[model samples]
Target: MSATDLSASPSAPARSRTVVASLRLLRSELRIIAGRRRNQAGILVLASVPVLIAVALKFSQPREGRGPDFISSATSNGIFVSLTALSIEIALFLPLAVAALAGDTIAGEANIGTLRYLLTVPVDRTRLLAVKFVSLVLGACFGVLVVAVTGVIVGGALFGLGPTTLLSGSQIGLADALARLALAVLYLSAGLAGLAAIGLFISTLTEQPIGAMIAITVVSTAMWILDGIPQLEWLQPWLLVHYWTAFSDAFRDPIFYEQMRQGLLVALGYVVVFVSLAWARFTQKDITS
Candidate 1:
């Protein structure tokens, strides 16, 4: 081949590398999801748990005793209750799932002695980590969306969806009510992103996926324990778990702007810190499996 033609061919490959690498990673992740039956089942169960609880509670109690309107209770005076049911479980469950997935993402490859082969395929470490993180967050978001959508549908179907009278005895229309429910899900996603990052970070720290998953679960539950103790109320403002139920405030009359803002900041801060640490740790660590 002519020198000019050879140089042009080299440039062509370089230009296609990023797209090719991303597609390869995406396909690999899809394959993993398809092959791991236990994990797949776990994901379905996690997504459905909230809806199941809502359904059972709807049947178990009298309409009036079940508290005020489900939407208003979740968004306003019931912020804590709604959060306890939805957001808290997400904060705990999602990280555990991510840790289970990510802890094995690299180490599993190493254990199989496939990491070296994958590394030689021309994907940079940064790109690989970024793709993995993005995939994890996306999966988690999907899972949380499943919970939110199911809860709303089941809750509304059973309890009836219309203007819910708030604790203040004021009424909110169905349109505004649905809008607030949607916003609460969005807010919950932010928290889940932080959790996914933490899981990935823990995953990078160990070769045992179960260990990583357990660590994430334990940390989340511990925060919740702290949140429950009245003496540690000051710590609530700083704890990641504290904001797990914070999304419920969106349905309130005036809206719990301060709580919502605090949740956003805390969640985003956790995401930044966890991802930064994962990058630093994963990049420098020796890969022995």
Candidate 2:
């Protein structure tokens, strides 16, 4: 017997309908993001930034010590510069990206009044929120991956492949360079995950997307300020922003595995707490708006 017969016999259509609805919603969400010209343009622009920096550095550096013996100093410099740029960019701009994308993910629907339409469908609120959160988080990850790969490719093409050289002393071989870069990217993503969760949490608090965006940015800025205060240095361990710069520790001579582990732990805690807060708040949210 087919699903039709099963539905006609005695089973509630709940499970089947939910599967169909989720697939449809996923398509709609992907279409909405993929079809937006502004989003596409923004991605292209961001992808270009790292490539442009690599090109500029390739041509601008004055000839110095015979680069790195085992590896090209130019490549090392490019990787360092690209990674450093990404770190700074994430610290300064990614909060805005997270706030802008995640903050608007659901609130935008409510603003335009389509949220009620979605609710009109038989879809459960819990499933709907879960799918939306997954889509948004995946999109954020895609953006970060774009930045990372572009940096590495551009650096390799322009400067030539080389060993991983650290500012903290010691040099990494080819295999280690690849491994370190992978770890660096993973570490960076963890930091961004916390930001995304914070943004998502704020999104659940308000119907206005702008309000949510601004609120999260404010939270990021406030955390950064507190993390920097001399008297509040003790609070650094509790601040997510404090770990945003810890990817550099991956380049240390002995590789500060302890610090990396602690950073990951802090990031994981932030993601869990913030996402749980968002879900808890959203579950009780009134659809009246």
Candidate 3:
């Protein structure tokens, strides 16, 4: 039945069954993502960044007082480990991870001859797209947490956790520092969610998962390059990546929330707009595969 028929169905039992099936499909999607070899490898690579950072810090003197304030602070406080690692990864590693997962969502299924089968199984395009987008978001969250959590553990083991120094030169206790790290993780995850939405829309345009993945990465990288150009200062705020590094503001003494809040709003806007575009395109596209 068509999605309209799905909505117009009068039987409560049918609607209830659809909900149950959708939930099961969601679970299946998550399991598939978790088991995918590329995703597993991506997680491992992401987790290693923090460990590497901690180890590097342990062996050498953090440049005394130069480069990413967090670097210099690493020797004095373990909390900097996660923050520094995230700073290093947010520009590429994190976005690429989200791109890999989001780009594979619909395109991957279609490439494997499963898209038509899914539709035949009574899974409407709308619900399927929702499941895919949600899986991407959850994937982004998992990827971000892997980096942050791994960093915290390794950093703590190497440097010992204690009060964290803020960018403003003020200090906060370990409890508060942990909270800020949580906020940064959430912020970066939200930013990646925006990219996932963009990738989801791109995934609908092609049957080749690799093409979609490359397209997503290109789009992400282009934005990064554009946001860095001094001439594009006028357009920087409009770019989604504009606020990615703004997560560091959380480390400021007073905890600057404005940029983070704006970042969230931008991310939310991207999610809504791109997901709507994906739904529109996927609902209308022919699923010959």
TM-score of each: 0.78, 0.81, 0.93
Candidate with the greatest lDDT versus the true structure: 3
* Cα lDDT tens digits for candidate 2, 30-91: 77877878668767866786777677666775555554221234445546545744665676
lDDT on C-alpha atoms for all candidate structures: 0.69, 0.74, 0.90
31-99: candidate 1 lDDT, tens digit per residue: 775478877886777657656666556455445444434433543222223333565466566656665
Clashes of each: 2, 0, 0
Question: Residue 52 lDDT in model 2?
Answer: 70
Q: What's model 3's overall lDDT? A: 0.90
- Compare candidates 1 and 2 on lDDT and give the better one: 2
Model 3 residue 86 distance off true place after TM-score fit, in angstroms: 0.6
- Candidate 1 total steric clashes: 2
lDDT of 3 by residue, 1-289 (tens): 8998777767878779878988898899999999989899999999999999889879975465578778888777788889999999998999899888976899989999889988998788999999999889999999999998898899998888987768788889989988888999999999999999999999999999989989999999999999999999999998999999999998997989999999999999999999999999999998888
TM-score (C-alpha, index-matched) for candidate 1: 0.78
The true-structure Cα RMSD of candidate 3 reads 3.9
